[model samples]
Target: MHEVSIMQDMLQLAEENLRKSGCTEIRRISLRVGLLSGVVPEALSFAFDVLKSGTSAANATLEIESSPSLFSCGACGTESWYESLRFECPECHGILILQKGGTDLELTQMEVSSTD
Candidate 1:
């Protein structure tokens, strides 16, 4: 249930911002979930459904971007995209992979509107 906890935290933060801005509703929430973020999209969606109950984001749509895992090989100094390919550089066949991206779970944007 890490997704539940994560969703709760995301909702709380958004709620705080909305409260401060005097917003009454949220139209959308956008996020970026990397391939290696260890978070399942289906599970996160479900968790959001459960956690959004009675919250400002209750009816908001979750816009998620599935980012692919990328890494740079130190041995060959090449950037490569490794989607569950054993973490090795395809060009150089190096065992060491310096992760460059696709390991982040971030809240990218939010849409808020006032009841006025």
Candidate 2:
């Protein structure tokens, strides 16, 4: 699955950043995943469990915050949050356009132990 590759990249990035900051242990990794990001949380977790071995994040807890897809109606100016694909507005039956907040997968925070 692609989640494995994604998790691998995330771990690599985390290790690189921790190394630069003189951190040797990772305590936590937080991510913001959007509905439109096409990533399954369970699959990502499984990927993390499989890929964390022998890395700085081996013991780290992964925290995922889900973001809902937002769409705005072009005709009615109504905004709505969607958990599934929606092409039209529910209020006025207008064409809906993506506004923001559900198309990105981002690393938000990391907790690490500094090597003194």
Candidate 3:
């Protein structure tokens, strides 16, 4: 599954950031996953279970934040929630511009312990 690769990459990046930040141990990884980001938390968690072995984030908790999809009309500049696949704006029949809420896979914060 793609989640496996996603986890592998996320772990690798987390390890680097943790090292850069001088964290000896990580307690949790906070991620902001957009609804349209095309990622499944369950699958990612499963991947993390195996991929985190012997790594800095080993056994670390994964916290996911849900982000909703927002859209703006290009013609009328009207903004609203985009819950459907159809991008047509309800007001002006304009093309919907997907806003920044969804389609993001960002690493928001990390909880780590000092190396001591």
Instruction: Give me the displacement of residue 47 in model 3, in angstroms.
Output: 1.0
Query: Can you give the lDDT of residue 60 in candidate 1?
Result: 89
Most accurate candidate by lDDT: 2
* Tens-digit lDDT track of model 2 for 50-108: 99988989899999888787799999999988766689888989999988878788888
Q: Candidate 3: where is the Cα deviation over 4 Å?
A: 71-79, 82-100
Worst 10 residues of 1 by lDDT: 80-89
RMSD of each: 2.7, 2.5, 3.7
**C-alpha lDDT of residue 20 in model 2:** 86
Where model 1 places Cα greater than 4 Å from the true spot, the runs are: 73-77, 81-98
lDDT of 1 at 97: 67
TM-score for each prediction?
0.77, 0.81, 0.72
> What is the TM-score (0 to 1) of candidate 2?
0.81
Worst 10 residues of 2 by lDDT: 80-89
